[model samples]
Target: MSTPVQLYIYDLSNGLAGQLSLMLTGRQIDGIWHTSIVVFGKEIFYGQGIMITQPGKSHHGSPLRIVDMGETAIDEDTFNEYLSAMREQYTADKYHPLEFNCNSFTNDCMGFLTGGSIPPYVTSLPSDFLSTSFGQALQPQIDALFTGRPPSGAPARITPSAATPDPALAASILQSVTAQATMGGPGPSNGILSMPPAPPVAPAPVPPAPSLPAPDASLVSPMHITTNPASFHNLLSSHRAVVAFFTSATCAPCRMIEPVFGELAKSKSKPDGGVGFAQIDLSVGLGGALAAEYQVHVTPTFLFFLDGSKTHELKGVNAPELRTQVDLLIYEAFPPHAHMSLSLSALEAIPLDPILFSQIPNLDTMFTKLAGFIDGVTAWNGAVTQAQVKQTLTRTVLPFLKASTATSPAQPPMASFDHWPTLTSSLIANLQLSELFPLVDIWRIALLNASFSAWNATKKVQEGPLNRFMDKALQAGDVPRNYLLTVLRMLANAFSNQVLAREVILFTRERVTKLLVDALLHDDVTVKNAAASLGFNIAAYLQKQRIDKVKARDDSQSAEENEEWETEIIVAILNAVERETNSEVTVHRLVACLGLLLRLSPYTAQVTSLLEALDAQRVLKGKLEKGGCREGGVGKKDVRRLILEVADKLCPDMAMAM
Candidate 1:
């Protein structure tokens, strides 16, 4: 008789991945899948190498779902021979979380047995994860774990009879029951093939642990009352570090330190910190049970839990001691990233704040420049309307700039200037590419006002005044150097306002990155410097988000979607760093940009690879050896110091070894 073959699908994530992957990865990943092939009344899977058990009776217990993989005519002896050959390729040490694992072996087996492949979702999962930014960022750590090391712990075993090893099998059965309770029964089953019963033997080795819940930053709140035992356990499980305050309703000491506790929660309550605070009143529901469980018999007692175990205790109303312990708890829970060990003082001093073009030009002279350009452009004959724009700038914008930019103790509020948007839009729409620079410079200063930038950012992407002007400049192609410099400076100023930073720079990063990359290669030194400033803004924004995500434990899509555009930007900066001979200022800014791109990047391997491919270390060493770069001048030491910092401190270990 032809034997039935089935694909047993187990969710190693226990269904949590389906619930959380969308929120965490910005993509809907159903599960961390593990699959095995069942044929000839035996279940086979690969983890610590190939292993077999009775059908649907492995340590995975019941599969999350099963698929009819069609029947295989291959006899038991031939199948066992195929398995023996497969074991050589799918050895314990050959396991990679992404590249080679259980699914890989099942797909191979399915191909041979039924001339079919594993479900595409099952097979494509790793590639899909590797495609995401978080995956790219985390690839280095994951790669390091499974690369060359021998698979540790228990080895694979074969169960010729219908049997499975103990405790592990029992636990797996319990887990399946729990999953069924929570997630409903297995996926639509096409009649499960039955096999002869056999005695349950010693338990199988423990399966790998599931991915944990992300330390919810929102949980880092003040010690709120948690009455239910299950809710309290969930709270502890959600955070890496937690503080529980035990108190009676009438305890005076608890009241004394209550404010202090609230303050501590407020101060240290950050998502990246992974610290949570809870209050348990001895007088209330389940509080007595929790107190008795942890052996807390006294009022106003504070218990600190680290990784779900009570590690320390304090019994007092002393605020200082409480503060000290909480600080220590947070420090222990979230250790600094390895990248923090580098000596990067020079690089650290490079300000991440936006470089603003806040220089207020002579309004009359600027207007004169614009009027002259307007008269010259045959395409723009709206001289009267253009004059009104100039009038509006002098009347409304000039005073706002003068007042807002003042150094007085109390500054006047920014005027509504409701007509400024209309006037600027009309001016931008009417002006030719050459005539746009003077008007753009005026708008650039206006962007320094929060109100103007807010209005600019909120407009439709294509309809924004800055967008319209930049589009014109991009379309014109061979623009004058002056226009490029002014436009670049305007972009730098856009970064000064958060709204513009998001909407203009970050939201339009593709177009802005392309423009900056091309401008970095411009022949004009001033334009290159301006482009470097804008590039610094982009890099700074990305790096800030990168660090914030690291600190907040945010695994969602980071600042840039993928490293392609960022790599393109970095390569352009590297080229700028290599080719520049005259200006150390340009070189300093370019090096800073490069440092920000590489520092704490999730793609350290990729960056190191790029640096090697471009021979960047040699180029930077050459810059260091250059006499002008080494020579004495204002901030020349900083220029040289930053170059060394980028080379010695920021380059990955692989690059350093090279």
Candidate 2:
């Protein structure tokens, strides 16, 4: 085993000194030292010290004297036991070596070092020597022992560095030695020293006590309430005005009112010292039962009590109203000498009526006029910019409708297309006399009319508006799904505004994609159509963009460029055709999108799982088509000519092959 390191000690406390004495001597001190040992409690503190031994003097009349061991372990059980014994055996009146030399010496030394008084020694000691002398002489020996190796055997004392004894310094030396021995000793005893047992330990500290809750003023008097229900009735009987506000954590409105209630409680005083406020959070245990008893359906219910009796109940109070109600309650309970009237005209300055749609009767007329304008542009083979359309819808259509509906008692014209004509007639008649008509609606009307003028020329005047009206009516949400589907089919067949047509198709596709993705796991046929529509539109758009890009490129390019361009063109056309006819396309829309990309741009084949999809549609379609009646087939000659025509329109380079 390694030699024990020496420890130096200084600045000894009386308790530490007594503890050290008990630890070293295996004996209890009496009176002062014993008291000191108990007073200092334990050695769980950090500090510094030195040790030295005197060559020719006895330490505290002990045959063997030891000094400090600067940083060394100690036998904790032996030390604790010894100190405990000293405390138990020593009396307050008797002065013995244990008390005088151990206890008094420890006390006085500590007092000198720590600037505190030495406690009186209660233990009897031998008559000639002063307590101070023993400490002073022992100091050097204590420092020396700590400076050198610690003692090897059980309860053995070792002196490290030798010092000449001065009577004045002897007391300090002895105290220092005691402190060192207590603080720095051999490791905790391994049952070697037989000493008295230690007392039972005190219980551990509990967590911090809960704080008292603040008073709540939202509850009305007469209602008995307490977070502790057993005491609730007692509290209510004592109070004249009692108010209970039931609240919860999740309620936003409840949280908002908490601070306001707290403020009210602080500002108001109880009349006859009988008013009381209580608030209960419904989130805690047993809160649900209490809530049920109070019939608290919603949060922040303020129940009022008058003279410990239930009075009025208020629900959902705003801050200002709550303050006013509380003030009124207070005034009623404790009336003032003067009465003051309050005027609320200033508070009522802002309008509070909700705007309803039926009030705007001309709204449908406005929409019709706008739709008419759109029709005119479509007829004229003209394009109406998105900005112009959105502006017309917001400024003209929405406002007119709001106004017309605002004046009517009947259900708003928006409910169905039946009232749209009445709304449209009013708008046209109003517009006919106004100059704003030419600047706004006319310009848009001219654009759309020009776009579709040739197609609608043979059609009658009333036919245009009637058709548009029918289309809008069909698209109305109140219409049955099958009827809406029929209308959509009719619109597709009748209209030739390819841009609008394409956009409508895209919109349908996106909606279908969402529905299909949500219900795909169910294996529904409706889901399949939706997925197919989405895939078809995506492939169509890809083909369109590819063709547009190709057509825009200059024809004065190299052969290699032309070949690459041809390949791209071929790929795009093939993808569109395949996507239109392929039943296997009924998978995830994203997968279908990836497949379209891969077919159009096969060079990206390294991207695995890009074209993978769960397609059961091919098998289903085969079964369906097999069961359908066979139709008349076109001759090869006519088919070849049709193919050639399609090739010429799409890829001129591939026309020869067809």
Model 1 CA deviation exceeding 4 Å by range: 1-336, 376-394, 398-414, 559-561, 627-635, 653-658
List, residue by residue over 308-336, the lDDT tens digit for candidate 1: 99999999888999988997887677644
Task: Write model 2 residue lDDT over 304-335, tens digit each, in one string.
Answer: 76766666777885888777677666555544
- Model 2 misplaced stretches (Cα beyond 4 Å): 1-225, 337-658
- What value does the lDDT take at residue 261 in candidate 1? 87
User: Each model's RMSD to truth, in Å?
Assistant: 18.6, 33.9
Clashing pairs in 1: 165-202, 165-203, 166-202, 166-203, 272-551, 272-552
Per-residue error (Å), model 1, residue 617: 2.1
Q: Which candidate ranks first by lDDT, i.e. highest?
A: 1
Quote the positional error of residue 654 for candidate 1 in Å. Answer: 6.8
Least lDDT summed over 10 consecutive residues: which range in candidate 1? Answer: 155-164
